[model samples]
Target: MIRKTSLIAVGVVAALGISLWGGSAMAQGDSYTIKFGNVISAGDTQNQGYALFADLVKERSDGRIKVQVYPDSQLGGEREMIEATQFGDIEMTAPSVGVLANFDKSLEVFDFPFIFEDAETAYKVLDSELGDEMLAGLQNSGLIALGWGENGFRNLAMVKGTVKTPDEMKGIKLRTMQVPMHIAYWRSIGAAPTPMPFPEVFTSLQQGVVDGVENPYELLYSAKFTEPAHYLTETRHIYDPEVILISKDFFEGLSAEDQKIIQGAADEMVAKIRSLKATISDEIRAKIVAAGGTVTDLTDAERQQWIDSAIPFYKENASKVDTEKLKAILEAAGNTTYLEAIQ
Candidate 1:
């Protein structure tokens, strides 16, 4: 009788252990939602690129996690969404690094005018150890930096006229990304650059609030800025990186496995987004011309003039922010550029 009773107790304990184990597993597999927002249209490159991340996360987690994309400022502007993500109101957001500098001043290094001579050079810089270090800096500021994406190179599109020289931009009221570096560059070149959110730019331009706007050709065309600012100048000035960011609060709550999935997907999406951006510029410029936009390709001399003009900007801003780090980034660019890379 004692032997039989002991066996029964063991069976009961085993069943209880299985039930508890199943319950813990189920709790971990419980469904969750991530709100992903951005400041671009649904079909734009950045949005399409972000879809890769969302898809990967869901696939890797087998639907335990879902990311709902809110494009066209359905949530809010870049800065607003970033703050929301910081506070855990939103799960993820991608914004031009230009605007992100406001949250972490260290990012301002990317804002230096005429910094990247070409997309290839920009790519090298972004994929380097220094770039990785810079991306990691966001964690200290309450955000998780997933990987680098593209904003492409910024160009000038104006309502008043085509800008072949900095003198042409003088006294022209222009709209700029709510990025301090962009505003400072425009101001240095003698244009009245107003900082505004992406959503407000279209209406603001229509109302004559600003005479011109600056962005990559893909953006200027897709955002339909080419509709109002019909003249597109191929300045290729600042090649800005876009950042895939998530709320540290939300990220902390996630299982380590999910975190790995999210970041891995982001890495893949970065490559996809940048590749698409590389080929889209020419195609989009054609679309702009077809849509009654006047396109101006700058001469080598004119481009050099723009480069030389930025020296003053570099001098003034480097000391104002993280000068040592900024100098390190600039040195990396100078040393690793294709010309120097070949030499």
Candidate 2:
């Protein structure tokens, strides 16, 4: 009778163990919702990549996680959305590195004019240890940096005339993103830099609030800025990168497995965004031309002139950002000339 009673007790314990294990597993699978927001249009390259990320996360998590992407500032403008993410009011956002620099000053290095000669160089630096360190800096500000997304190279689009060199931009009232580095650079070069929100740019250009605005060709074309500002120059001045951000609070609350799923999907999103970006400039330039806009490419000499003009701006502002990190980016891009000049 004692042996039989012991066996029955063992059976009850086994059943209890199984029940507890099942309950824990179910708890581990608790559902989560990520509200991903961006200022880009619904079908823009960035949004498309974000959509892929959302899909991948949901599929990988077996529907335990759902990501809802709100694009075109549906949630709010970039700055607003960034703050929302920081406070966990929203789950995610991707903002220009320049805009993000407002929250984490270290990112200002990317806003310097002509910091990168090409997209490949930008990618090399941003995917390196230095870039990761810079991204990690966001944690103090309550953001989780996923990966860098490209906004391509910002070029000039003028309403009246082509601006191929710094000399051409003198006294030209230009609209700029309200980034300090951007404003400082344009102001240093004698342009009347007008800081304004993105939504106001089109009308600002149309109503003569500004003579020209600078952005990637894709944005200029898509936003119909190329229509009002028909003179497009391939200055490729600044390589604007968007930073994928999440709320640190929200991210920490996630299960490790779900966090891995979200992060892995972000990595894939970066790759896909870049792959689509590889040819987007040329493609959009064609579209701009097809739409009755004149596009101009700088001669090697003109490009060099633009670079030289940036020296004063760099010398003045480089000291304001993290010198070591800036040096790393320059080294990564093989821009020894600039590194030497800045020092």
Poorest 10 consecutive residues by lDDT, candidate 1 = 18-27
Q: What is the C-alpha lDDT profile of model 2 across 164-240, one tens digit per residue?
A: 88987889999988899899999998899998888889998999999999998888887789989999999988999
User: Which pairs of residues have clashing backbones in candidate 1?
Assistant: none
User: How many clashes does each candidate structure show, in the order listed?
Assistant: 0, 0
- After superposing candidate 1, which stretches have Cα over 4 Å from the reference? 1-27, 335-343
Per-prediction TM-score, please? 0.88, 0.91
List candidate 2 stretches off by more than 4 Å.
1-27
lDDT of 1 by residue, 1-343 (tens): 0123323543454434322221342234557888999988888888888888789889988998888999989999988999988877888898899899998898998887777778888888878878877777687777877777897898988886798998788889888877787888889989888988788888888889999899988888888888989988999888878888887645544454565677788888888898888799889988988888899999999987887787777766667778777777767778333222212
Residue 338 alpha-carbon offset, candidate 2, angstroms: 1.6
